[model samples]
Target: MLLSVNNITIAFKSKKVVENLSFSVDRGQSLGIVGESGSGKSATALAIMGLLPPTGRVTEGTIELDGTDLLTLLRNQENYRGRKIGMIFQEPMSSLNPLFTCGYQIKETVLQHQAVTARQAEAQLTSLLEEVQLTRQLGERYPHQLSGGQLQRMMIAIALAGNPDLLIADEPTTALDVTVQAAILELLNKLRRSRNMALIFISHDLSVVRQVSDHLVVMYRGRCVESSSVAEVFSHPRHPYTRGLLACRPRPHLRLLYLPTVKDYMEERPDGTIVEKMPDNPLLGATRGSYSPSQFDPLLKVENLTVSYQNQINVLHSVSFEVFPGETLGIVGESGSGKTTIARTIVGLLPLKSGKIYFQNYLLGKARPRSVTRQIQMIFQDPQGSLNPRMTIGEALMEPLHIHRLYSSRSERRQAVIDLLTKVGLEPDILSFYPYAFSGGQKQRISIARALIVRPSLVIADEAVSALDVSVQAQVLNLLKSLQQQFNLTYLFISHDLAVVKFMSDRILVMYRGKIEEQGIADQIYQQPQSEYTKQLIQSIPQYV
Candidate 1:
């Protein structure tokens, strides 16, 4: 084995995070560690690299790379990290230093490990960028200037600067779009083959892991519940958790119900013990109900809308669509394809350069005296940025109600805030907490509650669930569906995830370069896409059997 993790255990402030987990990776082999968030995947990676945070410690374990024990290394052991193992972190934006250019960062990494001058390191940095399939010019840009995929490639370049024997990638492609994700995976595969390097691929997405890993380890609550070859494990999984994971993946051959949650498989045994079973939640199971067309009139309509920035570069060009009273219209396209511009224009946050917007048949233009902000709301992609950090959850939730004068008394508004919290599956006690106290999923749920508290007929969710884990995303999607049924709400769902778009949308609209390439019913569009862009989108989604 090129790398071996023998009976490892990790803890955080006296609480055990991972327990007695063992796995191995051979030269040129990929071992995937699959689990949900907080399942100890990142912690395990940190322990192996000897880079755990101050609060965390590897209580018991031995990490061996090529016959040497990494855990036994001294605190200031020279050349330990760079010469043996390397890591690619989960968030590229945060992992990279904002002040440094890509080339400078990679050069620093090379110089840190090797006795090389600045000129020698620069030449190596250019070669590293080419190895990762990035353009040489990208090396001159800062981290902020690069896209998510480019940043990730730069991260790989830095990690491979020392040419370690093993590469540990923790959710490396999480923030990238699907097409970019596929490209990155392909690049990683090629690099592994060329260098004969062992890989530890960690991610929550099983479908993504299956594409690159030869060996698979399924983790639950910090325990390794299943470990086997990727083909054997995915083809015929013995563990219930593994089966549940496989069943949750959105497949092209099957119609999706609600995604399978971990809670779905747990059962009480006759001996008063709980046991988990496989195939408890089937992907092809019948859903609660098919979406019915709304009886009410259209809530929001855009007729030949055109929007441009101050530079006169057209962002949205003659886009036309209508969101009915209780329907979901999913707009899908790559980055910078005018998705956010449409959402911003509809909420009156952006100035429309041309075309008309109608809310309940009332025109929306700069000439209008009244603000339609209350009836049409927007939930942004990043909840942390959208929400005020200093304000309590209650204060943020009450802003819309206060602006519209929805309540006569403060007591009534307080009760409404509690009700909204409960409606979105949060406790009333969370009202006093700040946005930073909550997880990504919780923040999004809070954002949803805030958007709906005003009783808006329309809600624009722009990549709302992109950052969430699969199980949490499933719950949030379910909440949105149920809320729509109860409130008769209309949604303008804007996302690049085609599976999600197919799952939630009544109608689908494919956009490319600020133009609508195709528009049709969800089923027909997904099954038999007429446009080339739509067809490419359907083909790009990762497949699961």
Candidate 2:
């Protein structure tokens, strides 16, 4: 085996984060380590890469690379880290250095391990960029100059600089769009086969892992619940955790009302261990009652909407759409495809270069009135960023109510906040706590509550559930549907995830380069996409099969 981890247990201070995990990968083979956050998949990768935090230490077992212990090599960082084991981290933007050019980083890495001359390293940098399907010109640009996919490709080039025996990709394609993700996976597989390198692919995404790995190791709460070949695991998963994960993925063809949660298949053992038993995967259908059948009454309208940065960089090009009451109008596109621009323009956050915006059949002036702001609420992509860190949950939610002067009485506002908190599946006690105290999913629920507290008719959810895990995403989606039913709220749901858009949207609009490629009912659009872009987007969805 090129890489062998034998019954490894990792700990930080008194707490054991990972326990008795074992896996092996031969040259040109890939092993997939998959689980939710805190399940020790990334911990195991860190243990192998010797990049764990200062407090984290491997307490048991041995990690061997071709019979040599990695623990011993950790003592000499220069000896094995860059030379033997290359790693691609989760976030490309953070993983790459912004100060230096992509070429400089790759060249430096090559020089560090191979002892190559400056000219030779430069040549090697060019070769690496080309190997990763990047142009030499792009290497000269800084990290910010490149797109997400480009930055990720640059990261892969850097990882391949020393031509390490094994590459550890930790959630490499998590942030990427479907097409970009497929390209990266293909590139990794190609490089792995060509270089004859072993791989440790760690991700929460099972379908992505299935595409790259031969062996699958399913983890739950720091334990490897099941380990087997990818084919076997997918076809005949014995563990309930694995089955739940398989069923949780939102399929392109199957429009599920709600995804199966991990709790459904799990029971607490007497000793505190989670006993996982396979459950029947039920296909539940959602009613379209929340969506208004009659689309004649439009709640919001955008006509010839054009957005640009400094009157130079054109973003949205004559973008026009109407959001009807009690219906979700989903805008589907990749990054920089002007999806959020429409949302921002509608919310009056961005000044349109030339456009007309009508809310409730009334034309919005140069700047939308405070009344419009109160009626049209927007939920951003990053829940944490949208919320104030210094402010408590109560303070945050109360700001909207306070701005509108709906409830002049503080006591009444507090009561409303408590009720809104309960509606979003959060308790009143949490109102005292800060945003940091909440998980990503919980923070999103808080954001939703903040949006709804004003009693807005139109809600622009801009990639709201993109960052959340599958089960949490399901919960949030269910909550959105239920709230929509109760409030009769009009929704402008924006996302790059086609499956999610299909599930939530009454009507789907495919956007590419600021232009609408196609627009139709969700079922018809997913089933019979007329545009090539839409067809490609649907096909790119990662399938468990």
Candidate 3:
């Protein structure tokens, strides 16, 4: 075996995070670890790589590589980690040093592990970048200067610098578009095959795991409840959690009135067993529309929109779209395809170079009225970054109310915040808790509640559910749908995940290089794509089964 984890127990302050986890991978083989957030998937990876946090410790078990125990090597400073077991972290930005060039980092790794001179290290760096399909010119740029895909490729280059036998990737493609994710997965598979490197891929996307993995482990909390070949597991998931994950995926083919969630698939108890129930979503039928683009009365309209940055890069060009009242207009595209730029422009964050925006038949100027701004709320991609860490959830939700001067009294505002929390399926007491204390799903719900505090008519969800687990994504989506119906809210939903877009959108718009490649009803766009770009995007979506 290239790597073996035997009865490993990872803990923080004596609290077990991953207990008795065991898995093995041979050369050229891939093992996938999947579960929801807080399921200890990353913790197990960190334990294997000897990169756990300060308080975290392996209380039991042995991780062996080629008859050598890695724990002993860590104490000896033998450089076993980077040389023998390369790690690709969940977030490339944090894994990489922002100050150093990508090439410098790769070269440094090579020099540290191998007995290579400066010239040899430079040569190795060039070859490694080439292997990862990153150009030599891009190698000179800093981490922040590169796109998400480019940065991830750079991470791969660094991981391959030492020519390790085993590579571990943790949620490597979570933030990427489907096309970029496909390319990255293909590159990893190719490299693993050519170099005969064992791999451990951890992710919440079961479809992605099925593509890259030979064997699979389904984790719940800290326990590995199920293990088998990828084909066996996908065909017949024995564990309820595993079954839930597989069942909860938002299919691009059909617009399900209610998404089957983890809660729906499991019985609530000490140990959740298999069960079935439709989640409560009264707003779904109420908000649903069967109208065409021409039929929808424009609640918010954008015409001849063109935007540019200081570098003279045209992020958006002649883009036009209309979002009807009580409907979701989903925008799907790659990282630099102007999806976010469009949202920012609508929210009055970015300078409108040349365009006309109207809301409720009123023309919005560069300096939009406070009333106009209040009516249009935006939910950002990063829920963690969007909410203030210093403030409690209550304060965060109350800020919008205060800004708009809605309620006259503090008690009334507090009650309003509680009501908002209730609407989003959160406890009223949770308002006193900080944002960091909540999970990704909870934080996003908090963000949704914050957006709703102002009673906005139009809500711009910019990749809102991109950074979440499949089941959690379903919950947030259902909540959004329900809220849309109850409040009659118009959603300008933007995301890179076409599957997610298909589920949430009333109409779909495909963007490429700041231009709309295709626009139609969600069903038509997904089922019968006209544009080559749209087809490619759809084809790139990973298939688990």
Q: Per-prediction TM-score, please?
A: 0.93, 0.96, 0.95
lDDT by residue for model 1 (1-545), tens: 88889999999999999999999998899999999898899999988888888999888878887888887875754466866688999999889999989889999999998888889998898899999988889999999999888999999999999888889999998877787888889899998999999899999988889888999999877889899998898788887767767766555444465666655665556763547754444543765345566677778879999989994899888999877877899998887778888998888788988899999999887654434667777888899989999999999999888888899988899999898789889999998999999998999999999999988888899999988877677778878887888788889999888888888888888888898988877887888999887888887787765
Residue 46 error, candidate 3, Å: 1.6
Q: Show the lowest summed lDDT stretch of 10 residues, model 3.
A: 280-289
> Residue-wise lDDT of candidate 2 within 320-418, one digit each (tens)?
888788888899999989999889888877888998989989998676678888899999999999999999999999988888998979999999999
In candidate 3, what are the lDDT values of residues 111-136, reduced to their tens digit? 98999899999999889988999789
Q: How good is model 1 by TM-score? A: 0.93
Residue 213 lDDT in model 1? 94
CA lDDT, every model vs. true structure: 0.85, 0.87, 0.88
User: Model 1: which ten-residue window has the lowest total lDDT?
Assistant: 279-288
Candidate 3's C-alpha runs over 4 A off are 268-296
lDDT of 1 at 199: 91
Error of 3 at 2 (Å): 2.1
Off-target runs (Cα >4 Å) in candidate 1 are 76-78, 116-119, 252-257, 267-274, 277-284, 287-297, 367-371
Superior candidate under TM-score, 1 versus 2: 2
